[model samples]
Target: MEKVIILTGASRGIGRAAALMLAKENIVVMASRDINALIELKKEIGASGGKSEALPCDVAKENEVKKMIEDTIQKFGRIDVLINNAGFGIFKRADKFSLEEVENLFRVNLFGVFLCVKYTAPYMIEKKNGQIINISSVAGLNGFKGGSAYSATKFALNGYSESLREDLKEFGIAVSLVCPGGVNTGFGGAVADGKISRDFLLEPEDVARTIKYLVDESETANAKMIELKPRRRKEFR
Candidate 1:
């Protein structure tokens, strides 16, 4: 049977790249808030002789996430992989940013992943085999001056992924976290606009390829966490 993958944030950037790449092998179920972009991706995958289905969902909304998972199971029977690539970072010094903005960042970056896992894990446990890949960030490992809120969310994700790995290992459900340093996606653009250099950053396809590798490998090769950083770049203090 062909493996089924549910990829969040499939409307654009790394999520879109992962959906396209994974669809070449597994059945990709794309979920994101942008219905139009999902339609376009459905066409792209179909044209490339791959299986894909798009579902509109805002990952932060529990009801929407629940519905998306239900629809995916109905369409695909079972899901073998879940790529939680649905997150964004908003940079600002802690004092300079409002509390509401920080909450919004957390809602999407951290809480949404929690909701996805909450809704998807039962299905995976029933099958007794699956993979969960959470796309965190380098900021998650260590904080930067202007990344207070965003960094906090990612840090939460890191811990969450680790705890999940421990809890789900017995169920044959592997959990992994990708902590990339500088990907040339909307993140890079955000940092660039904030006056940080983004030269020679890793592209979205680079990260997507790593994700594809993780999902395609056998259960024995359980990769817990992986980090990717740009070459010859200054480290954030």
Candidate 2:
């Protein structure tokens, strides 16, 4: 049977790659704040003879999150997987970050994941079958200079995913976290500045393939957490 999947942050980077890959075999509902990008992706998926739907959503806002979930349910009848890939990063010294900036980051990165799960879990629980994949970072496992604020959110996400896994296990919903290191994306607005080299970073397709693995794995086997990093370390720093 084809699974109905809701993928947040579908506009770019890992989310975009995952949407394209998943849509080839399953129904993908692409959610992101960039409606135009989602539309373009939708068209691309259609061109390839894949199923997809584009939705404009800001995961940090509860109303928008609720509406997106509700709308997906209305359209699909059931959601077989929820990929919480909507996130961004703001790198700076801990003291350099403004309170509002920290708050906004947490809202989108941490609280937003919670909101999506909160609204979507009930359906999964009722069905006793679903998958939730949270896209995290290696920053969650290790700290770095100028990454205090961003690291903190990912660390919190790590802890959250751990507990969520335990909570949902009994309900038969699998919660998995994917922590990738140094992806060659425009994340944190760093790629354009030439601060990092694309040669050493993991491609978004790499992470997308990992996501496909988790989705295709047998129901009895739950990959609690998967960490992915580029084989060649980023030397530029």
Candidate 3:
């Protein structure tokens, strides 16, 4: 049977690419705030003879997140995989940073991950098998000067993923985190402080492949955490 995958942030970038890649052989429920874009992606997947459903969801909202999970379960009967990829980041200095914006950022980046896992894990625990792949950033591993909010959220996500991995192990559920460095995704706009020298930029598809590998790995060899960075050069963005 084809696995049913719920992918958030499926409107663009890594999430979009991962949805397209997984839909080839899996039943994908694509969720994101961009309903229009999700529809377009679903159409493209249909053209390729892949199966998918476009479910508009704002991961930050608890009610909406609950509904998204319910809607997926109603349609697919079970969810075998969940890719938490919705996130937003902006460059801001500490002195000038907007606390309101930081709170909003954490809502989607950090809390979003928690909400998804909380709702999805119970079903996995019941089934005794599932895979959760969280898309984090290199910022989680190394802090940059201007990325106060984004870095903090990702750092929190990393810690959460580590603990979740251990907790799910006994239930036969695998949890993995994919941390990629400076992808070509245009969301990563400006770079200040330049602490993490972006000498090489990874492609969104590269991270997608890593996710697929983790999903396809043997059950015994649970791939816990994966970090991807392009081979270093002199300089990049």
Best by TM-score: 2
TM-score of each: 0.96, 0.96, 0.93
Give me the displacement of residue 224 in model 1, in angstroms: 0.7
Model 3, residue 21: what's the lDDT? 91
For model 1, the superposed segments whose C-alpha errors exceed 4 Å read: 192-194
**Highest lDDT: which candidate?**
2
- List the candidates ranked by TM-score, beginning with the highest: 2, 1, 3
- Relative to the true structure, candidate 3 reaches a TM of 0.93
lDDT of 2 at 139: 83
By lDDT: ranked, best first: 2, 1, 3
- In order, candidate lDDTs are 0.88, 0.90, 0.86
* Candidate 3 positional error at 213, Å: 1.0
Point out where model 2 deviates above 4 Å.
190-192, 234-237
- Tell me which of candidates 2 and 3 scores higher on TM-score: 2
Error of 3 at 84 (Å): 0.5
| Model 2, span 115-199: residue lDDT tens | 9999999999999989999998888888887778888999999999999999998988999999998887778744546655667
Error in Å for residue 55 of model 3: 0.4
